[model samples]
Target: MKKNNINDNDIILEDLQPSHAIHLYEMMQDDRIYTYIPENAPAAVETLKEKYKMFSKGSLRKEEVWLNYAIYLSSEKLYIGTLQATVQLDKRIISIAYILDPKKWGAGYAKKALSIMLQNSKEQFGHFDYYAYIDTRNERSINLVKSLGFKCVEYIENADYFKGSSSNEFVYAKISNK
Candidate 1:
């Protein structure tokens, strides 16, 4: 595995580190990106940095492993987003999560980053089910997962409530063969 970063298609999927918190936290401040996300949870840069430190170290539980990567645009020389994978070791499942700066939306950054992470995930954790839990109102994310060949396996009504929306979620999953 590449310890420094994984490069491809003009983007770099840098292994998540505490140092990335500053830019990421700044980027995430865009209100457009929080439509389906909890607005209150993003405490502060320091808090984010501390959380990232632990994520970089990995999950505290034995049954789960965490993998996070910061999406960097080589040409733009910026950190645009992040991808997170929570691997449930016992269940052989990888619960995927991701977020990109609203300004970078539809620029293909999320797709590329996710693809790279999925590939690297197989290398590090072996074949496992990759699952993305997306809010029903998030059509862009839902479409993105579908384009990546993730089938909607379940519809969870009231999975969460955030941003004045009673959230219904779609559990999307795709199995890894490699």
Candidate 2:
């Protein structure tokens, strides 16, 4: 794959790098950010290293299906968060996921990163639709996606919650290319 620079008024989407590990780890340590995300554990230096190694190997695999991006502040070049998309090759659809640093939550970085991912996915993978699975109680994230024109299509009741509490899973979708 190729790396392309995605610039917005305040943030940039760059190709993921080993150098971003520390910043990502620090961001993931915030309980607010990792609370709803089940797959993301508390990010430690060692965990970051292992994840980077695994991602490297996964990227090289012929059957690998995910694309990951690192989000940064364009002005200060600070790593802010991550965006990931998985392609369903058979269905020609892409599912998107992202997490922004809790420190920067109200600043619109997540929306910018998501817009870039949607555009890039259309250009590179010919994906016309974008989908996301978000916890219903994550009002910020749900609002963010809705603000981007994603419509909530359905809700899966009592979905798998990371913590002990039951949480509704909302499925949101948007047409990106067509």
Candidate 3:
């Protein structure tokens, strides 16, 4: 965890501390959660450590591929999961990705947290569109995004980079600023 200058009350989106790494590592223990993720199973502690190090090093700098945030419940101050956005500055668009603890699934935490992130990004980046790339098989996530106003733009075949030879991808978008 790099030295984070995030204010005590500014939602503390990124630059997570080492103390929070264990909780995040534990959250990755579920195999079902990694079904659509671009990584393999057995998400061990070392994997979490590597991810944290990569985040600390700010390695996703090519075109601002993505900025990851550790989602926390504001009232409980408990770490829920993560949200990320990949900004296409040329297009003035942002695509989002998120995951929550399995225990927290179906509780609307992902929706609420993602909504906050969308609003924050809109404020910071001015008028922009938001998009989501969801695994077609993940009906729950697809439905959740639809509920948030993202319309299905297209169904992509063999679109995922790390799919287990079984899943398809769908691109969805919500044009708020356009």
Q: Give all candidates' CA lDDT scores.
A: 0.86, 0.77, 0.72
**Candidate 1 residue-wise lDDT, 1-178, digit = tens:** 2355788879898889989999789887787877887655467899889978987987779898877889999898899988888889999999999989889899888988888888887888889999998888899999989988899999999998776668889999997665
Query: Ten residues in a row with the worst lDDT in model 1?
Result: 1-10
Q: Quick one: ranking by TM-score, best first? A: 1, 2, 3
Candidate 2 per-residue lDDT, tens place, 33-93, comes to 7677666564478878677656544355444367777898878768888888877776766
lDDT of 3 by residue, 1-178 (tens): 1222222352446544445567677776777788876775435767676776675555455555455678776667677787777777678889888878898899887877777777767766778888898888888899889988999988889775665475578999998745
Pairs of residues at least 3 apart in sequence or in different chains that clash in candidate 2: none
* Model 3 residue 28 distance off true place after TM-score fit, in angstroms: 0.7
Q: What would you estimate as the lDDT of candidate 1?
A: 0.86
Best of the candidates, lDDT: 1
Best by TM-score: 1
Q: What is the TM-score of each candidate against the true structure?
A: 0.91, 0.87, 0.82
Task: Give residue 51's error in model 2 in angstroms.
Answer: 1.6
Off by over 4 Å in 1: 1-4, 41-43
Q: Using lDDT as the measure, what is the rank order of every candidate, best first?
A: 1, 2, 3
| Cα error of candidate 3 at position 119, Å | 0.3
